[model samples]
Target: MCGVLPIRKFILLFTIAFMFHVSLAQEGEVASLSQNNLQTYIVYVHKPEGLHSMQSESLHRWYQSLLPVTTASTEHQQQRLLYSYRHVVTGFAARLTGEEVKAMEKKEEVLSMGLHPEKGFWKKSNFDKGVIIGVMDTGVLPDHPSFRDEGMSPPPDRWKGRCDFKQTANRTFVCNKKIIGARSFQVYDNLLHSFSAQPVDEIGHGTHTASTAAGNFVRGANLYNNANGTASGVAPHAHFAIYQVCSLDECSSTDVLAGFDAAVEDGVDVISISMTSLNVGQLFEDSIALAAFSAMQRGIFVVCSAGNSGPSSNSAYNAAPWILTVGASTIDRNIIATARLGNGDEFDGESIFPPNSTKRLNSKLFPLVQPGINGQMLSQNCNNGSLKDINVKGKAVFCERGMEVSRLDQGKVVKAAGGAAMLLVNQEQKGFTTYTDPHVLPASHLSSAAGLNIR
Candidate 1:
């Protein structure tokens, strides 16, 4: 699951939302955009079984033949064709105006196509041996201990994917047997100019997900001395591939489709996607749903995040029956952190930022202040620049959780304002669920009830 591109100008953030009727075996119609505005559109074509094994150059020419001839130069027309997909689906992604899309839809071979629009463990056994799991996220950290290939066999002979993390001036990445392939689809987006073209993970989400999927065993893994123990993915013996479809904060639908196209062609047994649109869309119109349908046709297991708006009614995403839609679930353990108020009221919470023995904050009770006592809207969340008026030096700042503000960022705001500690309380919707986040300052995430008492 990921963002969807609009029919016109490509925005930084694209999300899929719409309803349409179309199936791969039948002809489908599409709404047209203004010809003046040109953008990338996924074009699905009916590929013959013989074409499935065609050479790359032969396939490219077949895709190019579908486009209408124009007065533009050959090189200019070539640039318009972005990708020629053969496995995930018989299609191509190209820069086209509404007029061009209208023309392509008329082709008898074209199937339904639209704007480009997710895990888990098991018994440690041969259940995952010779299996290949494809991860479509930001990317992976090849050097992370979890991905090291010690004690692992080489990838199966059927594997066709290859790593694309070419050595650059300042960065280098290598793929081992455990992580057999790592390719980036973001280069086609051209929006990420600051980052390198390699498939290295800058955002930690991809690293975490990859490590949780089929990462190799790493002994004595822990965060800040918490949860100390060996860590390993459920499918420790499974070969995996990384498809970087997301950037720092955004994911384009076209890029994500390209990832699907590659993963399917690469012979992955399972494809894991942990991103989704804000709302649900039609099966054929949504990019992920469509690509997943093609992947399902190829016998690939598709697992997708049900979206983050969980614990809410109708919050499910990836509703297509062919895909396995998963959501968050509670674990058996917790990393407890205690917050003691001046009045001797103690609240037990959670935090992954373990206590540093050198800086014992429990020795004495520090002054605690709630910045929102005066009813300042932003102060309640400890947003940046919201605590400037509050004198919280040498004190612990109590903050309420708010939308669009990360818990660690709230701690940064409190710490920047000279506060000694942070007590992050959850919103009503969050209830008693507290995340064990690593905070910049000594912090504890409390529940809604705890927040009310603190208030």
Candidate 2:
């Protein structure tokens, strides 16, 4: 009976062992077999802490050796290791939310006021809804009160975006906090790099030019006080989108072109360019002009200041046919007065005045004088020269027209000599006004006779 029991137990153990071996063999065959003969799997490897640099290679070689000889040859080699922890895992299908869309749209309004207010023609149509005007200049002061409204509702969705001033690997597009639809396209060192603490107006020219186009009309009296300090722009209600195109030292044509392209792609409605270059052919072939033309074809208006070299035969980039050239005209078309002081009195000489039909001051007109003399006082003939010990404070200084120096340059001299204002008379010819406001402190031009009288 005992022998029979032992035999029964042996048969049972054999049967179980044989079934288990068969199952293992079937599993191994299935593992070796691949569907479509092209199956692949993605593997993410985590390295051991404090492992040597070569440990990964050594570990891979050891792992490869452990595979069955046949399976090893058939297995495809595909391995990826992540060395940096900065990147976040994300799928390509991710999209911006509704709130983000509104944020992006608001950037347009903010940019419009900063760059091109005249282009915001919608204001004329009573459309409170603003358009985007991109200013590819320096960064803007986002905290300026002109862009903020105390009681207005929040901006709509679609105007939100990111700002990447660092120009890191892929960071770009900064959204304005106060101005809805306002965004800045600063490309690190490439273009629009912010160096100082605030996007300040280092060169007063940019601030002046920008203020003339779309300065914020904060107070009700701003419109009436256009003749006063920091007057209102042509379009006060419009918004601004500032793009820092030029830096403190230099400006690059390539950066300007890139900024233009980005502005168009972002759907900016207008682009105001205050800068000018002498290279016409280069500007024409430039991708910036082409992009601007594309925007123009889409009904976008482009306005630019005529080079200060106007009132002469010399033409500048703004003079180009495709651009709207703006020439500087004295307010009310009045004759710009240039006065000179000597011996504590005012006089004018040889400076040619504007046309007789031109506007004049309502105050009493002093009698005209000759090239070297005034009515009562004998004038010192300093042909575009300076006077010594002259009480020029709160008074005008008269300088001759010729000296081969710019009127502004002469104005600086007068200003440095403690002169309050300057009057530059034409020396070479008549019927022309030199753009002198940009040069010296509060300056005006006078005819040769008016200049002599003031001198």
Candidate 3:
């Protein structure tokens, strides 16, 4: 069977070693080995209910008897058991070979075998009043008005988390009824970074994500005089337990696992992680995946961001069937900014910045320039190296999307080049998805066809 498959990919998969976990549940899932080729896996045994201590011990004894330790690839190193899941699933997690999987399937206690995803998700909640939500992200801005818990009672008695105040902006980590807990982690002991010692959210990413998930409502909410109005989280009444596991956009797997370890021990209901990588490693070593399995055992829902690498094949991250992945979208609401070309042609673009500081979106028109008109290679992408030669002073610089060119960073680079405004063109893959970012100067994102017509 293996010889009949696509030779290269199949061999690569076996060489790298994929992961799979067997469950005795009635439900079944089919997995494709086409995408993942990582070593190390987590094996799960179904936990049958109504079992006393002795009966549970018997199940464990029977499963452990099947795990025959083999010599690992590393010289003189034997196969090792990484983690034990006794509370949620009665099993041991380890790295096993294909032969081991066949042996496992033959065992009388094993029901079925399939590749389990490291990712997980849930949907359609009954909106339980003020349910606890644990947010594991960059870090939370505890003092931000979005976290204010007004007219709320005390923390749930089951909450066992504590707050950390070191190096915070307010010199203390504030937690009220809505925000039940605040904690930070930095497992990179040997790395060199200023905030390596404490949990402080200097970058506002954590604040934005946490608030968007579970922050309470705040009146007169506006950032830079835009999106001005009342702001509220998707779950306004939901209580939050904030875990800061990332610093400066570098999320450590060890730190993420530590957060999950605490979230489970402290009894969190739901976990919201807005971070995921394009490539996932082995499940046994995958910090988030391993954590999600344990959380699922305890009936916890895990939600994650699907990443912006979409519109391309395999550009998606967090593809593990267990984790719920979310893609961003635009509503029917459109704020029109008319970009009238010099040749009497006009194209509508999407933008959030005003013509001036106190103005609305697309308040006025400015002279637009294509950076490549001066014969600059890679200039249209607006990367750092190409900005010096182009004279974008007092003019809107046109930029194309892709090639490690962050959608938001294009505006920043154009502004730094003394450009008065920006007209960003999207690639065809993006289609009609027009996204607007806060620009240092007035900037708008247009569709690929709109950009071609403008040029």
Candidate 4:
């Protein structure tokens, strides 16, 4: 991953969030409605700057009339307008049916409209000075040496945000020269209450992504004696602010919008979010997309992840074309591991073991076995109860991927079963693509072809 992302290449005219697919709010507008039946869409109302609020309301009313707002909504709540963009693009994002979108499109005030999101790509570039990237993710671990502000200049004078400025575990986290601001949101759907927490990250995901974006340089960085090198963010000299939008599974729309709102208000030049919703479309009704559009109007670059559901067709989220959606690509790096079977067949794979772990294993081989349920090959599941009755003592048991459980849990189950090591096999659909994950025991994972060949 590149260390820091540059905030250049912003378009000035179009209020942009790349369009993805068509929406069907009800049976009449299209054959079938999508999973989200909210009749919601981002309405791109075309108008010049400086229009009166009354004119904007007229446009909003015309759009909202297509589908009557649910009564559960208050007079204020019924105005389910997430963003009213007036600068870069003169439009409002709202819940509109397919017929509404079509009818709204016919209006002279509307520009363009369509489905959800698209794709993101990254290229190698040298870091430039004076960029303040806003990172909206899990949260940052302020104490990691990588975040030190030594030898760095003061934060850019334009920054106007505050530290979440709370104390936790008797430690107070305030912004320094590197991390210019910190905040957290607990909103659920823009109607939730507020709470505070420390900025120190309990989960490493936020720190990892933040560091990759603009972390300070740290020497001797490695993954357990692997990929040894100096560590730094994509734009090492760039200042950054943190908006902790998630402590739960992914980020709720309310929280994500709160993060974007704060970032734009704080004069952030760019926003990078590594969150997405599964089975959700690219409707302006989506909190993140709507907030991103507003940020775009203010000339802030927005970058997001394309998600890890790849190696399968149509498995990507955040495919919005206007937003920069990025995907992970492999480098030349690979962990050195081998799967040697009892039949003298040896195949190569990857592992999370340190560079010197082979010396500890001593090139030893143990009885390799694949445990399954009911002789149906499902025994290799390796989940908690999937192996309780199996005799895995002192043997190297092979586990199968998928079943919606954590990969590390499989290794833990093997270790708890008195097994010496764990051999994980990928599902049939997953190919040579592999990720190095932690394990409770000495373990490695094989590709579908490799594991099947071994079997």
Model number with the top lDDT: 1
Expressed as tens digits, the lDDT of each residue in 117-212 for candidate 1 is 201124323537788989888888788888888888888888999888777787677888888999988774454365556888886878887777
lDDT of 4 by residue, 204-267 (tens): 7778888877778899988778778987766776777888877644566656667888899999
Quote model 3's TM-score: 0.60
Every candidate's CA RMSD:
23.9, 35.3, 20.7, 20.8
Model 4 Cα displacement at 112 (Å)? 49
All candidates: TM-score: 0.66, 0.47, 0.60, 0.64
Worst 10 residues of 1 by lDDT: 13-22
lDDT of 3 by residue, 1-455 (tens): 23221111000000101111122322112223222322344565654454435465565454555564443333312233445556776566545556667666676655554445433212133223457778877667677888788855577888898866555454666567877887877645335554544455678777777777766778997655656788766666678887888766567666777889888888788887777642455555455666888898898887766665546897655556777766664455666555767677878877767545625434455677787765664788888767877788978788987657787788888988888778888878876667766666777788889987887
In order of TM-score, best first, we have 1, 4, 3, 2
lDDT of 4 at 153: 76
Error of 3 at 86 (Å): 50
Which portions of model 2 show Cα errors greater than 4 Å? Answer: 1-124, 141-200, 218-230, 282-284, 297-300, 311-330, 333-398, 402-424, 428-445, 452-455
Question: Model 2, residue 104: what's the lDDT?
Answer: 29
Q: Per-residue error at 373 for model 3, in Å?
A: 3.7
Task: Report lDDT (Cα) of residue 121, candidate 3.
Answer: 19
